[model samples]
Target: MSTNYPKPAVRRLKVYAFDPQASVTLATAMANDYVIELPWEQRWEAPLEKGPVNDYVEVIDIDPAAGLFYAPVDLDDAWLRDGGLEPSEGRPQFHQQMVFAVVMRTIRAFERALGRVVLWARDERLSSAELPPGAIERNFTRRLRIYPHALREANAYYSPDKRALLFGYFKPPESAADVQASWVFTCLSQDVIAHETTHAILHGMRQRSIDPSHVDARAFHEGFADIVALLQHFSMAPVVRQLLAASHGSLREPGLLTGLGEQFGRAIGRSKSLRYALEALGDRARTHQGSAESIAAAIAKLRETTEPHARGGFLVAAVFDAFVTIYERRSEDLLRLARPGLVPGNGLSPDLVERLTQEAAKAADQVLRMCVRALDYLPPIGMTFGEYLRAIITADTDLVRDDPLHYRVAFVEAFKRWGITVPGCISMAPDSLLWDSPRPEEYPALIARANGTPEGETPPQARMDPDDALAWWFADMLKRLQFDVAFDQADDGLGERSAESEEQASSCKVTYTRRDYRSGPAGGRNLRDLAMRVVTHNQRAIHQWLEQCTTDRHDWERLLGVKLTPACARVADVNAPAALRSISGGTDPDAVPNVEVHSARISRRTGPDGSEMHMLIAQIVQRRRAYFDPEEQKAADSGDKGAIGALRWKSPDFWFRGGATLHIDLRDGRLLRVLRKRIDDDARLARERAFRSGDMIAATAAVTGNPREPFAFIHRGS
Candidate 1:
């Protein structure tokens, strides 16, 4: 149990310069010390059930061969005492450290892109965006568990059920032709670890994406994981420079950045990597941006492939292609900057190489954020490649209105090359696919209510200062909500003090402080926090009202299993305004215009194939659970007296039991349709009956010692 104690903070760690593949061909192969601010430790044998002992990561080398948590590199004299010259030279301790470092690095990247904390699905309390009682929240699965040697095969996976990353080590190919070595450890490979961690992080954000109901669902998982790993390669300045120096600015040429999991591929006796860069499509295969017909042809060819990897690879290729295009364009300017006037045709200067590398790195960083942030704009379920393209466009459009460099245009061109077209677009123009903001006239009540005036009274002059303006606006909104609240600036009587006097004083005097109190459930919370709560409450109320109207109009009957209730029937708020704010460049929440929650109440709808149905279409349909399963009570009642660390079987963690699609008319505030998730009773009964009959036959055969087929007696009579 002492081993479960928190590990000391890691100031710096020397890890592999890159993956083993990059080390083989790049000059930047020297192990570099990476700074990790959080604490981490290795728990060789013990496993943690929930809370992490450390802040960073908890490495659980589940393999029996993984002896005591001995990480020599953690000590100051590791390089002098132990022969720790090269961390990448296949040491068990180094492998454990590398896996932990890479996983944390990947987590940080996602956090940076979202501009907020990255919450894992296992963090039950902060499951949704709702803030908890403590103004500040810590990670539930604080230190992500890593199984460095979980299996003996060339496979690695992120287990959502366990909330741990399982990495495998495989024996090299037996054939003499395969010269890589005896063992291929996936944890050692940066790409492999990064890829697996990305899967975990993405699932944390969107759990529904794991359901492979649609083709894009699984492919998105694989492709997005690869993209994160691929972008990480560009993140390291040294790695980019080495690759640029080797290829002489021709990124299309075979290099470390062009291929993924090189060491693993070679060990398996493969000529190429698991995946190659899209630039390898060849100069002849490249589709010009202007050639729409040609791009369409390429897309048609890609669509012919149904396999997840193949389709996913195509998407990776498409995005990578855009990165390459941007890199090339940005590098041209750098090339000229390296050598003023006409650039030399001969070898380039060292300064130019560094400049060019920086440009490429910058461009990749932007593209990476664009890809990750786009996830917020995507649908909850049933996404297509084209829909992803639309998400990218809309997400970028919301953040940056003026794209003078036409970075978005370049992405549109790249997507077009692969024949990835936006669904329901009026034209091929990039703006056509971008998500539209609500018209100003849509939500008049929000402004009317927050106007800081009674029904028959005239409003006072607005505050000119931005902070004062927001404070005033927030107060007004609270008043409109019928909440009894008061706000006043508590100006400290103390005025200007000499610099020496201020320094002599223990603490500085408070110049300004706003005191606010509300007579409601949100009383003790911060005033701004309460304002947000009010806004959120109002938004959900509107949605629930619309839903109630629709259900009343339809006169819906009760289902077989569900117990209806006022709270259970209430529709969930999809947090459209927050999502919009993510892309919206507005600094002041008060200054931002009221969000228009648009919806359509259609009597009938028809598909392009000519099929028609009477229904309503919502602006945005969110996936919600029909009910919660009482798993904790079931476990307690089962008389399982095991502690948190006990290895007991747990029932499935289905966050949502049953699913339903609520169609709302956002414009008119109406819930038009309810498409509930259906279960086939006939299929369920047949399968259960077959299982029971087989069990009975198996029991009889076991007792009689007769190796007979299940239900053979019944067949004999026939």
Candidate 2:
């Protein structure tokens, strides 16, 4: 019944020194006392020749004398040891920092998991830009934030295929080299730095899990990062002290540590709370910006619309809930840690910080592992919440081999609360394509098969229950199905969320087609999804053709789905002022005005390798292709209108076997840069990779109904 916890592995940590003597550090007398949290065998294997270019983060040793510390080298003993070597009496050491606070360790573990090397701050190229018109000119570059400057002016990039982390925030690591230049990102918010860099890691290691195509995945990506940043405050002794003092143990109270970014925006002049937005939403949820209704309602109408990250969003939800649990528990415990002696005059004590921090970090690591473990339940491409649970149960069974009771009990317990019931998917193998099995300590299944279809391949006969279809497409059910109190089977609990329903899906059906010989492999979702998109496209086209603007908010809601109700007829103020606040009561007033219109209310997920570009066009009718200024990018970026060079997927010759090697051609405004490439491999590997790519985004795929034949789908960008 209890966990037979494995003996802790003794880790031999080799801390690479960043000082003038970039070698001599660490106490020789000390045993390998550090815990090897992840087994070395669990580390991802990468060919030595293709060494981690972006796997490990590059760190700049903060020269304490100058007072600017962008980064401390990741493996430095000074950063890892308690009390470090700093002579300061009360100042905390690096080991004392929160688990996420140990930016170096975060980089190190991520690199091992992803098999890439990170280019730390010391490896960046910097250049100053002369003022463009309307640019807020400033000489105090040190005060500027990191990402805006780093992304625009810097050279670093996060590459998924390469699994590398690159940073444009570098300065010289050599002592002899003088620190002459001033970089734009000298003053960075810890939360922003953590959140943005995490996107890179998630992209490389768990690409499908965070696909923006799915609402859960998109919200998860945003919300989980927020939780990570929020929990990170527990790691910093001073930050925790200030926060607790501000809240007086009321962690849930607004305008303190929990003030969702709006009021904090007033404090620092930023638009949103980089933290606590979810907690502020209260028991009753609203839009992300406190605008209209909850995003769930908006997402309901978008049932037919599949976001790239939709399937993976469930994992994000699981992570957020765990953080919610942990924080609530920790907040209750903080009462015990409070004292009259700590705050000097009040009751806050810094001494309690050490234990509280260690506990928080340990809890975070466990949460991280649990979330990582949950990825096994996730399909590499698009999946539904029901299917996601199936994946989780199957994955956990393999990882713990049923020896750990918590794996089963914990997951089943956690999911049921969120309306996520466990499915009958437990497996010993990690997947059919790979021989590898799941690991409790290590992550498997980060990558999705090119094809969205599962290798199980065997399809289940449709019992023809609405619950069956609703299992996968609940969002659509919420949109289309109508239930009245008078006639609806309320006792059946046969609503959208329930797996049992009185109504059956008529207009839509999902079919997973791979070959002529193989049919109905669990009645795969390809057909169901395709039907939805077809309807959506037609609906959109018809609405646009109508040429009549809506008088109210819900005017077009019915047009989005089958159900039309009083809610659908409600009018919205077309000329109403911009509601920058989310329904959840967060605000982002200072957001760059040029950013594209993402509905602040709802989060949308996408397919695997979730695309940053949302544009999807049947074919741009516009002729005499025009080269316009940067302002037109939103059209292309949103995946709606014609962006240049979107035909790569359509071009079978260029995109077929092994597809074009992609590079960024910023030389012009194009998002995709490419060197045409083709690869030849053994038959099996080829089929698998082909399926993976084609199903995810348009590329070469096995012609449905033909195993031997492969066809090219239009690549969005070439």
Candidate 3:
């Protein structure tokens, strides 16, 4: 492609607002069709061969049960590119288009929130010593594969092992006589597509979160995905306006906007959608308008629910409740302006409806951003709903110093109503819930070094603190990462460009003329391109730096909450060729533990007052072999070479991971806070053992030996 050729900023595609079934209704027949706009790919070559592939996802329409390979939708085709293949139940290409568009939209939302390009989970096998150098980076998955028609059953899920999404289609049950469509495709549903995509994205961010470690572990995955999917419906203003018109500008009412998987739910013989966030309000509450008693009963029911979807529903409800509160607060003035004495039965004027729709959409967008931003602040493993609330508070507080809109307050009150409470917090106040800041006095070494005299000559009050040095060293490493440059360029290109403006730019018919889209200072370099370049080119350097930080640093074991010395006895000599010899049992007692530098990226967020806060978010992970047997676990914990060597050479029952997520302020070289899970915490270890031995194991047990495909089982019946 020539540089002079004009490339469109966005590609508009028509899709169903809710699902194909919504179009069948006489009132929603025309309103159900929605046109979504995606970023245009100027580099895509050969429209027919490319299919609906993009930088983040690839749509592969393969149906094994039907023994059919549906031709991939050529999104680059001129006619299709202009307006997209019309929403149709009969066409398989339309299904491909729908999945691709929704997946990209979800991905873009995440990238915008996180301020970086999304990277899929790396292949675990490539980390072995047997693999050649640079194999991990060379084999990094850049695009998530999307199979619109893979299974014959009703379930659809994201497979971490295959790095693909498998969407299924099924015939409407005989009991579902009201369903108009004979076959229900999960790919056609925007909620289903977005939900599965979130799983993939979340797994990439925290690969170990899929483990069924506790009640909240797996449930968090299901609930968070549901929340994302449900909130996404409000992003489309036109759709929200139409939905508001039906419900009289009330989100409390039962409607397509609040329901998920409507067509599939109906096809599966359900009177309603698969799930509703408003259900947390209780039937009586929704029917009889709102009441404290009905809300209290609903919250109690949420506490009793244990199944993943049901439990996760409470999380969705809590978040949706916050959104509702925020929306109501924002639109209260508008409601009053419409009618001073606005009664329950009074009709909303067109102007009031438009204003309320905008308020609802804005509130939803803010809530969604807060939720997504909280992901970076969460501990890399073992996430709970209570901790998630803290993450949300801390993340939002960091970006927006002042909460004039009371968004954080709304989140806190809602989570509390749903029985979610953070441990160790003095109160439900937002300030109390914020992650504790690192005190310099507690870290004597860093303070001494900062105030030390010379390298050789120490001051009277000088004292060496290895842990503080490590923190500073990590900060220096972040400085070397050069995230600021990449993010600065990304801001110039992507941050300022709004979806509305992009759609308008590409709306009019135009010819491919001499024009340059790369006229900006970024020069066509995006955040992904720049960030990936830094990571891929410096993979070995990063590994070496991490190894150096962990080597012989006993203080790091306490500072990072991970074991650094006394490498696992089960690790083969080939894997640790440079292992330090131990006096007892000839084991490698001094060998350095494997430290995984999971991710280091920049977060550039603009506050409500036009203030910018740039941060370097990094995660460091270390895993230790854990045993189910109490005696064997004691032996492993003893740290005695002879005792550790006496244990069986067989693989342990599971790996216990400990790591910290570091939030470094770019304005100042300060380690703001560290969110960590301790690997050697006896209490946590006991909890893990009990969880594995108890019925919780059944919650996420895989049909096959492969545990990586948990979503297959999680979404089995959904």
| lDDT accuracy of residue 49 in candidate 3 | 38
Candidate 1 lDDT score at position 248: 71
Comparing 1 with 3 on lDDT, the higher-scoring candidate is 3
Please name the candidate that would achieve the greatest lDDT relative to the true structure.
3
Off by over 4 Å in 3: 1-9, 42-49, 128-136, 282-303, 340-346, 450-475, 479-530, 536-543, 549-555, 566-592, 639-648, 696-700, 703-705
Kindly list the per-residue Cα lDDT of model 2 for residues 94-203, writing each as its tens digit.
Answer: 21121122343455534432222322211112221343321221211111111222222223223232222222332322341222223312112244344445555444
| TM-scores for the candidates | 0.60, 0.35, 0.84
**lDDT scores of the candidates, listed in order:** 0.52, 0.30, 0.72
lDDT of 1 at 181: 54
Clashing pairs in 3: 445-465
In candidate 3, how many Å is residue 40 off? Answer: 1.3
Ranking by lDDT: 3, 1, 2
| Candidate 2 TM-score versus the reference | 0.35
Models, CA RMSD each: 16.0, 24.4, 8.6
Candidate maximizing TM-score = 3
Overall local distance difference test of candidate 3? 0.72
Root-mean-square deviation of Cα positions for candidate 1 versus the true structure, in angstroms: 16.0
lDDT of 2 at 504: 26
Across 648-672, the per-residue lDDT of candidate 1 in tens digits comes to: 2233222222222333332333333
